[model samples]
Target: MQTAVLSSRSLRIALPLAAALTLVACAPMSTMYSQDSLPDAVKVPAGNKVVLQTVGVGEILYECRAKKDMPGQFEWTFVGPDAVLKDRSGMQVGRYYGPPATWESSDGSKVTGAQVAVAPAGTGNIPHQLVKANPATGMGAMTQTTYIQRVATKSGVAPADRCDMGSAGAKQKVGYQADYIFWKAS
Candidate 1:
């Protein structure tokens, strides 16, 4: 009787442990951050791999101004962006801003990039974008970045308020969020 009881207890513990291990082993190899499902226009170029990822939470500033080359017409033009960059755990890791579109790490490293491509995200959301990074400054997480992809965007579109002559010179702030994936040459 004693031997049977011991065996039963051992089996109970071992069975769950084995099942957990099996489930872990069968889990997919890919991480949650894979760019494979993104639009082709926003994909990082071949030979590049993701080095860092962050969530940008902030607002975009738009200024009402006369439309270029369209006399007597006016519109709201993008002035710039101001956002705080945070890691997956929600820790503030850096900032993103400026007319030049700069990404700066908490460690003082930073990079500016030129727009490479953009794809429509959806109604009421900003477009997904790919940027070709310039050389880094100050050396850190941003140093090795060769490209940046903005994905999973939410609610960054321009304000719907009128931009006609009456609304000209007015500024509007629109909140938005996006996942920024930094890539480097493989």
Candidate 2:
């Protein structure tokens, strides 16, 4: 049987194509978030890169109260949130809760942040949010956190229960789920 051989013309084209494919395959893969499609208001600032990503499964508490500056009008007012933070692997790594909004790791490192901006997620969903992290409280996973983003919101909106004077002082807990992406300065 005669052996087939590649012509010099074919070798020139095939070699470069094969080399390009090899380079691409060997390149480091980045699973990091590309916040490009997110709304500008909720996008993290430049010079930062994703450090950790966790899902927050939780509830938001709301209390029926008189609408501020509107006598006799009542509505549901935000109380706070309580959530369990889990990594993509479904392991519990931390928690999120508070009047001041804290994120704490299982290692005991914790952080609180100030809201930077928020953008509408959708109808019947809480807004996506960006926060600027405060200095961490312990040495661990959260120590270098510079920003946190709340995204992929499900539910977590204000309770739709009757909130007239009759319902005043009543509290409601609404279940919610969201992804919290943590970032650090690159």
What's every prediction's RMSD, in angstroms?
Answer: 6.2, 8.5
lDDT of 2 at 81: 95
Give, for candidate 2, the lowest lDDT window spanning 10 residues.
Answer: 1-10
TM-score for each candidate, following the candidate numbering: 0.82, 0.82
TM-score of model 1 relative to the true fold? 0.82
Q: Model 2, which residues run further than 4 Å from truth?
A: 1-31
How many angstroms is residue 47 displaced in model 1 relative to the true structure, after the best TM-score fit? Answer: 0.7
Candidate 2 lDDT over residue span 64-148, tens digit each: 9999999999999989999999887677889999988999999999999999999999999999999999999999989999999
| Candidate 2 local distance difference test against the native | 0.91
Model 1 stretches astray by more than 4 angstroms: 1-32
Query: What is the alpha-carbon lDDT of model 1 when measured against the actual structure?
Result: 0.90
As a TM-score, model 2 comes out at 0.82
